[model samples]
Target chain A: MIPTIPQPRLLTAAYTAYVVTFFVFLALPLVVVAVFAFNDSQFPSLPWEGFTWGWFFGEERPVIGVFHERPILRAIGTSAFVAVCVSILSVGVGLSNAFLFNRYRFPGQGILYVFMLLPLVIPGIVLGISILVFSSRIANGAWDIAEWDIEALRPGLTLVILGQFSFIATISTLVIAARLQKFDRSLEEAALNLGASRLTAVRTVTLPYLAPAMIGAFVVAFLMSFENFNTTLMLVGSDAPLTIAMFDRLKEGSTPLLNAVSLLLMLGSSLLALVMIAFQRRG
Target chain B: MKAEARIGLILLLTPLLLWLSLLIVIPHIDMFLVSLRERVGVGEYRISPANYLTFLTEPLYLRTFARTAIMAMLATLITLLIAFPVSYYIAKMARGRTRSALFLLCLVPFWVSELVRTFGWMILLRETGLISTLLQWAGLADQPVEMLYNDAAIMVGLVYTSMLFMVVPLVTTLESLPDEVIEAGYDLGGTNVSVMREIVIPHATPGIVSGCIVVFMLSLGNYLTPTMLGGKDSLWFTELIYSQFIVRFNWELGAAFGFLLLLLSSLIVWGMLRLTGHTLERTMG
Candidate 1:
């Protein structure tokens, strides 16, 4: 390392101390969360209860582990289902956005490009509320005018997916577009020059090149959809996602079972994060 | 364009048009329209600005709104101060593996849901939690201290939630600074502080502005962190919006509050970009 000057010993020591403290502060809460997960107690707080797997595996009436908890399990399933739908939809729309922005120039393209970023700048809560208001208005109009009730437009999982897709598509677009910008046009041109049809050239050459980005965007989008709370909270009706369920339980009271669920979430998300990093490195 | 290419362009544009219109443009327009409608009777309504006027007249709402804005700005500043040195250390001082590892450490917490992170803080700062226990054990307090349910607790949670956003951008900007530039500054007899003030801050302005924008917006719109950490006393503006929609079931008022929040945040972000002489494309994109 090149020092601008001989760093004063005091400054260097102080910086070192600060860095250590900063990391400790970052890790402390997460550490406490994980530790209390296994603690053999009713509460998630201190007083070093002996470690037990009851929070995960206990069959007792009071210590109904997260696995055995019906609502929690159902919420997990709901979250997974929503995440899958959001990822697929986001990636599909994202691919279209990438092609639209990258492959052609059109009227209002600059304005459209800025407009595309509107979802990112807007708050998540407002996004959800807007969608909620708009869809329900449509639903009411449909019923009133045409005597046809549109169930999908009501506050439910479908609206949840639509709400998340509003912004996630922007992200997937950014991810895929970054990769698309680096593409060599001649590669597709060469294929076209070799008597291959345009569709064949794109399918054989361009789409394969974009595969890594699509996959990367898929994973990132899935993680985001799974962990989302603010927008999902507004859109969810009966089938609450894991986050909302956990939030409700949190408000009711503290329990080691909540810690157990938190530990599981941490581990699951850590695995996804590692997968994302690996994909980024490889791509 | 030729016929085939024209049709292909139409196909390409269809999804963008539909997605933006159906999900974003139309909905927001509908929200604006809804915000202006006042319910006159059970099933009757009229165009009015009563909802917006209510926001202006309610002292509690006004006070809460101001408090949220001030707290969010304070949190953003705190996040910047804490992240700068750590980012510098990771970007300039730390070696290869250590740098990546430290950066990864910063990112890992964010990978989990914000609920989990806030839950962790709740466990630590609640009256009967670890910090209070430690204080008692250390003879620092005679009774358990209620660290949660206060503005300071909310600030702590907000900063923790947004620290990675600040660090990632700062590190990206700092890493691009050539070492020779720093060496040159030293060669010209510049001290560390002066070199940092002139060279580093200028180079990092785009990153700083972008990071601040994101952090400020996040802190302002945050519901889970403030609600969970600060409890009923949080007085966060987002809570007002949430209750109007969820608890009170007043869609018109909620829509107005949502728009006000949108307007305020957009104004602040626009002002920051202008003050820093950075475009949103350059800073955010």
Candidate 2:
């Protein structure tokens, strides 16, 4: 076994070229979006006009920034609110489910585990329709009181959060469950042996270890809910998320304003990802 | 203590189970029932396979379904091929910081919405697109060539979007392989092709299977990329489902189509798992 052999020039060149080309392919589209966001031209593509901040900050007719736009701002607000609610709901359910699966050996656990993954397995469009119709007919009717107006029972932000949570929580469960798998049960046992109550033992020892994962899951779930379109599209009524708003505008015809929104979103996601990696590394 | 733990477990499991049964399981059962019935009279229906039969008999529905399946499969293969080298470079070839940076580079683009990503392609491949402009500048064409509203553009969009899903698994699996093993093959006078065939492929089969499965499912169920990039004429199967449910208000037919999609992808994935002898747990991630 020789430690070294000179690689053929052609093979090395081919491999290098292959890697570089793939990187460009992976990058060029998003880069195109960001670059075109600043183009003074109204078109999202083509011969570059001189740059302007019209899409972002200009107050004139076409230059009105997304920040100042009303519908777009409302859509952003709706998206953020729904995403936050979904994240919190998902993390709560997921942590409980994760605890149930990871800690105990229960009958039918296998069946429940498989059932949990069905949300991920089913198509988003199908899930959207399911939630939409189910809420409108069956679930809504069941929860509807004759004389009471329950704002939470409708197919708006509440339904959106519920729909997203059904699957996102399962994903969150998987993440937290993975973290839990590495835990030494004896730590909890040791706390118990030290005369701490069972609740206190879990609250102190196991919960601390699970905190990092729960936080990670929260961020991941929030981002997932924000980006989700197919399920959200059908489930949403009388209110639009950023994706639906952008989609409606795209159908009408796109402007650099959409690109500006995309640029901001891309930066936000990049920062979140960096923060996540840093947080995980530090933990 | 045991009784307490049992009560706690039941309490913990109740909400998720109730949630799934209400929102997921029952809805699907209802969808299944919807798929089984056709409108006999106003508000009247019977259990029959009329919807499924329509899917099988109608050439338009059948052709669209077949085409979407074939196209999605092709996109998965293309994504796998393109992502392999990038994953290998990051996992096997590159050193510490360079590897992380390259991995991050692969990831950062996906943070944008899928719609936005597809829109980027729209901007790039339109008649007056950057590529068309570049071609004219390089004297490769006389005028801006119309690149949009075509299958190739759709393929490009699908492949580009699915890159991350494919790369992550491949990199995860490849990362665990000791360099000494590859070096050993080289020392044994194994040529590149033989070594890769005997060593790399076998070791990477799980990652490859998982990646392919995920990409295939995602692309098949995807409604955005094909419609956006391929324009009105794409006739993607998901679009047909959309029209059935939303446009035509034919939930029975749409339910059938939706269930068929789920069944088809599941069957293909199941068959692949059996063929490759991979487990659901291992391939899922």
Candidate 3:
């Protein structure tokens, strides 16, 4: 409903307050982490003990404290590796699924689509547990039958990537499918009529149109995979992802170094997003 | 029709089919089998319905499911309430660069991880945190308020996380409404409140329902928010499921709980579609 006489000033003031408050809520923890990253204190809580760059690039041999932890770095690297793999796998799978579903009409298509979406509806914890138990059982049963040692079935990087890909691919499919729905089918038809093969038509016309959406889907999937904790925590064997590492640290006790790690992650993601946004603008 | 097209379809579907089979279908089949089995000592399985029967008969597990359902409903309702006005403001009142900027601001929270975002609320609600400090400074409380690690904090975290999901869809629908229709209401001597109640609300029903469905499903499935914000003793249904499988090594009971959650969410999604007069496919699309 449109009011005849608009309360412009009041509306603007209220909106400004809301926006400011939202940003405050969003930025407060980040600001805390960024500030605490430079804190020389052992604790994550306040009562600062001056400023130091020890956390960021500290160089003492076998450095003690939270700054020089090997596991934390390893976890971060593992998370990055897993995220990349999941992103590539999800995007590839999602794109093909999108193309098939969008272009074709087939029997039980509705049922197939529902099956695809099952992962999104199911709880991550349940998925993780089921995958872990199922994989272990299969590995053990196979080994007992063959009378051979098979150690590769343990949950680790592979399981983490697979678990994340289960749902993240669904997200990618939905994003790309939505974009595809708006695509000009006539463009592809025209390309085909103008002597292009179906593959050539898709490559020359449809693929370019879907590029931005695919990229967006990739970024979103990658971020989701990277930040995923529930599935990763359940399925992680010996090597922890970054989120699990942080959770372990928090369980032990909160330290400024944890905050420092959070700060680094925040900075890393924000920079990546900024670059993507800039590229989008240029394109 | 074409051989190449047929082959393309097969190639496209093969990976997805294999993925779903391995990761989803196979695991679910295994879960169903395990659900029929009983835990015999540490890390052993035996065929029995003992765990399922226990979940059904036990008051604690039953109560946990009920409470989780109630909490999820409350969270969905609260998110809808808060998101409606904000979505309306953006979709109706704001325009030009201001609207785009405001929309971007709404999405900025998505950039932060859910774990990190929940952590933000934890810091705010803590004894020595900003909220407590503010209340103390304002003389509204003699001491810092004890608002953290409760059902209320859990609701806050859930609502905050699911809010954007509600807002985005609402904005899409509300933005689609023609300004002329709204102005015509005013021209016909209809009051603003009546116009909204009679016109805008009806038009926005589909979006509201879709948003509510998404938010409800997410809230019902959420585990981390309740665990972190509500603490160890929260007794959320998902947490119960997690405990059963991870801590107790009881897959059967966990499967029952998981099935219950899936059933509830599906029913809610069905109800949402029926109420909005839209199919699930349309709403999801």
Q: Which candidate number maximizes lDDT?
A: 1
Fnat, 2 decimals, each candidate: 0.69, 0.49, 0.38
Compared with the true structure, what per-residue lDDT tens digits does model 2 show for residues A176-208?
889998999999999999999989998999989
Instruction: Please give the lDDT score for candidate 3.
Output: 0.80
Clashing residue pairs in candidate 3 are: none
Candidate 1 residue-wise lDDT, A1-283, digit = tens: 2454578788888887999999999998898999998999899988877989999988878888888988999999999999999999999989988988898988899889988877878889999999999999999999999999998998899999999989999999999998999999999999999999999998999999998899999988999999898898888898899999999999999899988998998999899878877877787
Chain A (candidate 3) TM-score to true chain A: 0.89
Tens digits of per-residue lDDT for model 2, B1-285? 788988998899898788789879988777788889889999789999999999999999999999999999999999998888778878887888988889888887777789879988888889988999999999999988989988999999899888899999999998888888988898888997887889887998999998998899889988888878886667898888888887898989988988888888889888889999987766763
DockQ winner, 1 or 3: 1
Give per-residue CA lDDT, model 3, range A87-187, as digits (tens): 99988998899998998877888988988877876767778877887888888888889966566667788888889999899999998898889998999
Better of 1 and 2 by TM-score: 1
Which residue runs does candidate 1 get wrong by more than 4 Å? A1-5
Give each model's whole-structure lDDT.
0.90, 0.84, 0.80
The numbered model that scores best in TM-score is 1
Cα miss at B256, model 1 (Å)? 0.6
Off by over 4 Å in 2: A1-5, A139-155
Residue B158 shift from truth in candidate 3, angstroms: 1.4
